[model samples]
Target chain A: GAGVSQSPRYKVAKRGQDVALRCDPISGHVSLFWYQQALGQGPEFLTYFQNEAQLDKSGLPSDRFFAERPEGSVSTLKIQRTQQEDSAVYLCASSISGALGGELFFGEGSRLTVL
Target chain B: AQSVAQPEDQVNVAEGNPLTVKCTYSVSGNPYLFWYVQYPNRGLQFLLKYITGDNLVKGSYGFEAEFNKSQTSFHLKKPSALVSDSALYFCAVRGLQTGANNLFFGTGTRLTVIP
Candidate 1:
């Protein structure tokens, strides 16, 4: 695809339910990132992957949040036992070099609503 | 820890007038700064970044940002505003200790260009 793609643009989950959001980055992007954007707030970093390695996940709010990029091109974010506070737009982005100053290409995020 | 701040919750500008969105950041070392724009129901779109070059950085849609290390600020500016430019703007920063992969963002500012 010409741009990053995300699945289930909108997700409504019951409290305690498990939900998964997927991201397919640009064809050759090397760095993938996950962020959570709460209403009226900027996106907060959740996790980062370099190739298939989960290099940084220091931003995951709790144990319920998990993310993986098994093959390096596609990634999934899983939230277990979802809570109302988990409601937000989950954004996925990818960069070609993974450099600190590189611009990222973002996908249309998946808006998750936990009831 | 690296952090960015966007003090204004919202900003309004008349079409054809100049517009500015202020941002300030704190980091342990030389910072990597970025600006992103988000339209309603869409993901972030990259605008510009300030790495190690001249303080002025130009980006998409005739937008530009000025990096002021003395003030720890990176303010987004446009010479002429358009109603179509109304959107949410975000500022982000990454420091050496935070690694090159993860970005810390500030609460966004909603820009309204009134016709």
Candidate 2:
């Protein structure tokens, strides 16, 4: 792909249902990040991955939120027992630089709505 | 902690007029400032960043941001506004905050360019 790609552009999940969103980052990107953007709000950091290592996840709202990048190129964010407040656009971004100060390439994002 | 603030919820400007979106930041150490634009239904695109430079940084789409250390502000400015430039603008910052190494974004400002 020419840029970061995310799947399931829209998803409606009943309360308590589990949902998974996927992201495919640009080739050779060293860092991948997950963010949650509620309606009318800026994106908030969820987690960060450097290769297969999960370095920072202090932003996850709760234990129900989980993310993984097994192979480092593709990543998945799984939400268990989704709640109404979980509804937001899940954004995935990648950067060639691992530092937080560098520019990042972002995907279109997957919108998740929990009823 | 590190955080950014965008006080304006909406900004209106006439087409071809100069526009400015204000942003202020609070961080632990030095600040890594960035500006991003998000069009409807699309992911955020990076505009520019101020790492360690001449305080003025140029980015894509003829956008520039001035980093002011005294005021702790980084404002995005454009000499001429365009209809296509009407979008949500976000300011983000990263700092040496303990156990926090991700960019913290502001609420965002909606820019509307009247034709």
In the range A6-112, model 2's lDDT, one tens digit per residue, is: 99999999999999999999999989999999999999999999998899998899999999999878999999999999999999999997775778899999999
Residue A53 lDDT, candidate 1, scale 0-100 = 98
Residue pairs with colliding backbones in model 2 are none
Expressed as tens digits, the lDDT of each residue in B15-106 for candidate 1 is 99999999999999899999999999999999999999899999999999999989999999999999999999999999898886788888
DockQ of each: 0.84, 0.68
CAPRI category for model 2: medium
**Candidate 1 chain A: minimum summed lDDT over ten consecutive residues — where?**
A96-105
For residues A1-115, could you state the per-residue lDDT of candidate 1 as single tens digits? Answer: 9999999899999999999999999999999999998988888889999999999998999999999999999999999999999999999999998788888889999999988
* lDDT for each residue of candidate 2 in B7-44, tens digit (9 for 90 to 100): 99999999999999999999888888999999999999
Error of 2 at A86 (Å): 0.7
**Total clashing residue pairs per candidate?**
0, 0
Runs in model 1 lying further than 4 Å from the true structure: none
TM-score of each model, paired residue for residue? 0.97, 0.97
